[model samples]
Target: MPVGEEVREAWRADLDPKIQAVRRLARRYGARLLAADGMFAALSATARPEHWSADGVHLTPAGHAALAAAWLRLVA
Candidate 1:
């Protein structure tokens, strides 16, 4: 989990600015951005062991289902 946390820290450091830029552009253009990364981060916060595969990075079936549900909630 520590490794996952480290990776998330690095990922946010690199991506948060880019996501912010995209958010600005989306706001300007009246467009939408579906940020799956943020969705996954939220899921990971409450993740069960079955949520991840052996590799940890990849999602298991249950995880994929959960993510899909989250996406639907965002879009719906």
Candidate 2:
């Protein structure tokens, strides 16, 4: 499938702040970036990777690639 705007939007809502902080770190070396809703929610709720995956251990290669590609967009 072609890369589309919805991919970026979903990543932003569910993943962008993490990616943005990573990008900032790449550009700023040791400097810190601001935290957002992710941290606020983390403080109030349990952390979860399963929320984003189908199973605890196994993930389809497409799923892995989609995750990797999202990060690659930030670094690239």
Candidate 3:
């Protein structure tokens, strides 16, 4: 498989289950889950290279701004 497909497969196999578990635990505790995974997935679908670092594991400044915006929206 290509590198992109590998990454997507890893996300589905690894990160997705962790996100689901956290969402479930947050609901059980009545805590506010940030839902960053869904937001990042949506942003990734837009194919915005600037939002991600060259390593593809970290966020760029634009990505941080977007995260802050999401947090504000959640708290507001």
Candidate 4:
């Protein structure tokens, strides 16, 4: 499930810039940056509302599992 409109707005306005800054810093420091946004987007494309919490800002159990799977793939 894609994020709610309001959440998407907030992400674009607030979180996205912060995430980008973090990525830039990681690059500057020659540190590994695990970019999870794409993974989350992919999951959201396939997931249901139940995958997220009621507030739609947090992950539910299934969402966490999906994220873990993505993280494992990145690490492996």
- TM-score against truth, every candidate: 0.56, 0.28, 0.77, 0.69
lDDT tens digits by residue: candidate 3, 1-76:
1237678687679877888899999999999889987787788788665454444567778778888999999899
Q: Which candidate is the best by TM-score?
A: 3
Which candidate do you rate higher for lDDT, 3 or 4?
Answer: 3
For residue 4, what is the lDDT in candidate 1?
74
Error of 2 at 6 (Å): 30
Count clashing residue pairs per candidate.
0, 0, 0, 1
Of candidates 4 and 3, the better by TM-score: 3
Estimate the TM-score for candidate 1.
Answer: 0.56
> In model 4, which runs have C-alpha deviations exceeding 4 angstroms?
1-4, 49-54
Candidate order by TM-score, highest to lowest? Answer: 3, 4, 1, 2
- Candidate 3 least-lDDT 10 residues: 48-57
Ranked by lDDT, the better of candidates 1 and 3 is 3
Model 2 gets an lDDT of 0.49
lDDT of 4 by residue, 27-69 (tens): 9999876776756666657865556444556777877777777
For model 4, name the residue pairs that clash.
Answer: 1-47
| Residue pairs with backbone atoms closer than 3 Å in model 3 (clashes) | none
The 10-residue segment of model 1 with minimum total lDDT is 48-57
Query: Any runs in candidate 3 off by more than 4 Å, and if so which?
Result: 1-3, 47-50
Task: For model 1, name the residue pairs that clash.
Answer: none
